[model samples]
Target: MRFAAALTAGAALIAAILSPETALAAEAHELPGAAMSLWWVLPFAGLLLCIATGPLLFHHAWEHHYGKIAAFWAALVIGPLAIAFGIPSATQAVLHALLTEYMSFIILLFALFTISGGIFVAGNIHGTPLVNAGLLLGGAVLASVIGTTGASMILIRPLIRANDNRRFNAHVVIFFIFLVSNIGGSLTPLGDPPLFVGFLRGVDFFWTTVHLLPETLFVAGVVLAVFLAIDIILHHREEGAPKIKDPTPDTKVRIRGLANIPLLAGVIAAILISAAWKPGVSFAFQGVSLELQNLVRDAAIMILAFTSLVVSPKEFRGANAFSWGPIAEVAKLFASIFICIVPVVAILRAGLDGALAPLVLLVSSPTGAPDNLAYFWLTGALSSFLDNAPTYLVFFELAGGDPQHLMTELASTLAAISAGAVFMGANTYVGNAPNFMVYAIARHRGIKMPSFFGYMAWSGAVLIPTFLLAGFLFFR
Candidate 1:
């Protein structure tokens, strides 16, 4: 894989340097297009090619899971550097800038630490549908207070433990992701980054909550209904599994270490302060300040909040069966995702204005485009594979030109971006960072999880429809 990336880099460098001036000019001035651009399609094509050649290249290792490694190597190593040389200079500039920016790194680190905290806290929970649901409900509210990433990290292990007895508890975690980790956070600027971005764009923080609550409730209601039905079925299935006698009744329920609550509170306070703090606004400096603030807050929370975890007695930690395994898994796998998506994000941003002319022309048309549902679907589809944050930015910037119906267009566009990125993020193992964390944590606790393809089948059967319905309700 490294050799392939080196080859790709060599080819891209040759293309960039040796091409004629006319060719370079053609590359620079090429029509704004989607999918058609080599920048967008080439990497995907290479992924497919890698999948096809996986068997031939790895031979015996092919049977042992080499495909994932090859794909990862291609994406992390070859993907960015190749596109930097192959794509126009503009695309290269954005990718390069994002890589160097410590804000992105800090944001990612915060996510990592948040996962760690969640694993530790949630590990104490035992697998029971009621307990799990309670934990998730608490997580949903906490997510708004501490940030979704933080809540996810702090609660995921507990949620996993709460459902440990039921094999069919995927639905529990699925709904957890849908509600607690994603949609529930819409009400606060501290809740989700997209809303936070909106806050920075002149929208007041409280106003965001006022406007978002209805949508959040609507989504939550539907998800809760689905969860109840699935949990009932799983409960019936659990009756058939072997049951062990309880040796210690309710000993695990004792709240001996209630002191940790204050530490958790400290974490939340730090996050709120960080979110509210600003060095005023500057067109140039706003980006830098926001990014730096996130870093400071992330570090503060990790350093300060962990004191509680450390001071808690061994019994409480043992009851939760807490360990560092799940967070470690999340860190290892997500690095590939964060790095690989850089080029895809750059290409999407570069092309959003030019490609999908039918949609773009309409958005620019006097009648205005019909909310570009096609663009919504396309963005949603790619967002399933790419990090949805950048995907949201791509479409938000794409719809920026519609000044005549700016509010309506921007609202529709934002709705689509938010819905697509958040909802479709459940589509695969790598679809969202936390999805993999949940899966890994579940597996480590002896819960048999579906395979990658198995998970997609489940998602296709269930979540895809929910996503489609969400798109209709929100986008229209």
Candidate 2:
């Protein structure tokens, strides 16, 4: 997997240096999104649907062929696009997406996943309700610092170990997903992919911090309060039952692989530096412009991640039970998603003239103003099913792709979109990557994690009403 990531980075460098010019030209060719019909989006929808249903409907086939299924859907879009528009046009769009969007996205995820895997939280505490809540709260805070995936990977095993003796422990893991894996990631670009996508598109680094703080606090606080109440009740309920033995005895909690902490800091530093240091130098290939600072950021992050691998002990990684499978799956599936998103982005850019005009109107007020509440719900609804990053891009484009305007005049609208995308990703397991990863880790550690739909039932009963209150209170 290291070889694969290195090879990919090497290939990108090779491609950039080898053939610098092409018939695709320097300027981007615009696709006529307004001219396209609804059928153009079928492949995108197909891929998303397959992603949603594949695991449950056919676990064997999905586990084996999800990449192929994603490719098939992507090819459906790419093929017809080439025939409909000239090959150069299609090539330009897809290449731009790959070079500009997908490259940095996957690199950041890979770097974080690699670095976080090296840090082993090597002890556990007894699962008192207060202790469980403390861990969840601590993780929720840590998530904004080291990304949801990183935080989840670092803390989930310890969390599971803490709760192993508790009979009613699934709810703890579920709320962890709700808080740690989704809502907790709202404050920073380093926290989640959706916010990072916004950063790449020119959102200010502190924008979410300034704008979404109240909403994040409201939602997280409410959810935490609910968790405490339920956990207390469940803890009491377990008191009457025959005792279950604690497999992992509680010990003084210690963190192994302390070296990775600095590497994680390096990643955060790299992103901050990139945002601050715009050298105005860029490389152009097939009409895609790769900025110098972004290139340097990705390179620096990869280096830091690799450095963690070398610095951290092998036994620490084994103790952490780390594997590259989760990030690898994400890399493949998101590549296909980015390819499929080309025309959809074009359609969104067309605004009221496009096939998705109804969707646009649905999120708009009668006076044609952007409806903050509607933006919250609509972006959240799609985000709950499809991946939040792309779902964010969809609404970000819908709300007008200008980050400057979004930062000021329609700040609330952008806030709504951002809040929705980040917060509602907790609504289902498939909504965000770390949700399923945490579930998988818990189940492997012998915690009875709920089934996919059963997990949604948990979210539905808890999260939906919280979101509704938040939508009305903040967005309205």
Candidate 3:
């Protein structure tokens, strides 16, 4: 019966996509009007189907391999939809928006250098309370500048490697996600993709920091306190147990590759340049106004920064122990997300495009807040399971319709989305792009990581209450 219903729905989507009204409108740009109506639901269904098929598909595989299956299913569903409905030119516009308008490369490059620097100087500082505290602190701070993914890739493996001698370190990584990977991205546009989209749409960049600072600090402080308590308890357990003689250190803790400071500065400059570039042309392309200046700026900066990274030497990354695996993982997962969600994004764009005023009213508060922080939390919750970047763009375009509300509201709401997506991602390994990558790498090295539901339990116990507190404090 369910299969029959899905077939009917699929047929209806085909008709909707091919409807004469849409076809004529989309002909010039080849925007795949026929595929747009049902794009969102298809991948969503595929995600669920993959979850449902888990037992049959990877029964013999390790539990962690479920994500690979999920990624596969998502891509499989995306391929047919792309062929049937994709408009390459419009798709290029979307990609341009993603790359240039959002300045994603800026964030990626910033993360590369920042993570490398953190690893280079602090990589060996593990196993002691001081080192753990520093890592947690450094990770939190870095999360704001480089993003949760950047911070996690640079830190998680080294952290696991450092604490290999301890039996009670499982919970440490769990809490690490809460603080460093998820919650910390709340402060700036570079911290989370959703907020960056908001910025591209005209939300003031500085306001993001000002509006979200309080909530971010609160979450970080609480998570840190919880982590410390757990660490103390675990540290004693290890101390009381047997200890093996340790090998002597080869070199002291002095910072190596200090000369890379210029390269590091170059990375930051590249990010600033990319982000500071503004789109000058605002004329409509296929009925949608292209923010050309902003797009140009974002694309240029990202290109330069990444190009610099490609040209730099191996010695500059020595202490950081930088490698390609984590970034490759991020690229793979994001590729899946980008392709699978394209239809969904286009569908949402079409649905909400004509209904902007009403949609804004529907999402807004009684005060007619230009944008509501409440919507951020709702989207963020769903984003924990789905993809947050496109989810962010969905809400961002919705918010762009209203120009009358105070700019502060827009900043606050965008910040809320950023916080919610990054933080709640700790709820499940699959919640954020890098969460599972960290899990896979950690487990491969023999860390006894939590299961999907197990991670959720941790989030429920620790992060959820904190997010609720943030909602009351900020969203209201």
Candidate 4:
């Protein structure tokens, strides 16, 4: 049923691409952000809070009826929007968020998940201190290449298996989320969604690579060093205690599903081609306008994902323990998130005239200059929970929304925003799609992973001080 829906959607999109320009009047159907009160954002806030507390507070109910909970929160926003803004206006807002924002976001993550899951690491190795660090480093590098989703999916099972013998291994997964899933993706747009959002908005592909290198190194280096130190102590402690039998101690480390490698490259090429091939052709669904290049890119990527399913052996995916549940969870939760974020984004678009004026004020100095330090912290803080991509977009516009200006003269501020959005996503489970996915995968493997707040405690202890020092060193 899901496959048929994907094909139908692809066929309709291709037909739309082939049809004559059907854009709906190229007019801005913007909500009145200035007039909307803070109360309008309650659904968004409430939904996020429920996401954080639901599992810990009511495990069985949340597990079974999370979708219903998500729908309830979405209705809270949608029902009110219809009452206050009229059905047409509210429908357009919700449709725009779903069709434009949520569609592409999920497609990217879905493609990465599908393709990478086929490329199984067939065996596990011992989790020595240096060995774990090496895996983290390798995954970090790969995150920028194939994206965080790809890197996490390809490496995580082996990582778990490697440490399955260890008594204390949850910290390993914690640092994996920090380094591989979030921090490592800073170097390229392919690495993280927020950077990709910037790219579509006209930021140069290499802009973040050049600007964020030093900051990326500083944070990655510090966290990695911390992981090494902790792993060493834990390794020594485990040696003194009775040894836990290694489950897969006999098999040697090897890579399977080699056929999927070129498909991964195809995914990258599709994204890059979309960026370069503008084509000046676009179609609209109601008020939302999507460019021709983007639609083609998505369809092509989905094709590649389908191709992986055809070519890769089912045994490889079985060995990796790949399942559709994690992506489904992400899809459902973020659908609610994107829907709830509509009014919040509208209010942000209102600038100083809106309810978040105090927040809008902080990113600037008293002299009306772009404060790099403030931009870093503010972008990072919001990104800790909110979708970093849109959070980055909001601040990108707040920083004047000019790609050339942001890339050149206001480079420091742009760097701060980019750094914050990419780096600080590690601060919470829901900060990026992959953060929660990685958490889900680890827990499903029987690792007693931390709760939402417990994960925050880890990030709060490790990431906060690192950001403070790095923020002062560079952005300040």
Could you estimate the TM-score for every candidate?
Answer: 0.73, 0.86, 0.73, 0.93
Which residues of candidate 1, in runs, are more than 4 Å off? Answer: 1-36, 39-135, 240-249, 252-295, 305-318, 352-366, 370-379, 401-412
| Candidate-wise lDDT, in order | 0.56, 0.83, 0.60, 0.88
Summing lDDT over every window of 10 consecutive residues in candidate 3, give the lowest-scoring window: 351-360
Native RMSD of candidate 4 (Å) = 7.7
Per-residue lDDT for 43 in model 4?
82
Q: What is the lDDT of residue 105 in candidate 4?
A: 83
Task: Give the clashing residue pairs of candidate 2, or none.
Answer: none
Number of the top lDDT candidate: 4
lDDT of 1 by residue, 7-105 (tens): 777756643542223233335423222323344445444543443354356646754554365456445334334343434543343344344332443
Candidate 1 weakest lDDT stretch, 10 residues: 281-290
Which candidate tops TM-score?
4
Per-residue alpha-carbon lDDT of model 3 for 278-383, expressed as tens digits? 5455655444455655455445545544554665455545434455544554454455555555555555566434322243355666785644556657566657
- Every model: Cα RMSD to truth: 5.9, 7.3, 6.1, 7.7
Question: Comparing 2 and 4 by lDDT, which wins?
Answer: 4
Worst 10 residues of 2 by lDDT: 18-27
**Tens digits of per-residue lDDT for model 2, 1-476:** 99978755654443333223322322336677776667667778888778667767897998899889999888777666655565677788899888877888788778877888888877778989999999999999999988898888788877887888889999999999999999999999888889988998999989999999999999999999999999999999999999999887666778888888888889889988898898999998876788999899999988998898899899988876677776778778878978887877777667788877887788988888999999999889878866688779889988888999999999999999999999999998768878867776676566777766778889999999999999989999
Residue 93 in model 1: lDDT: 36
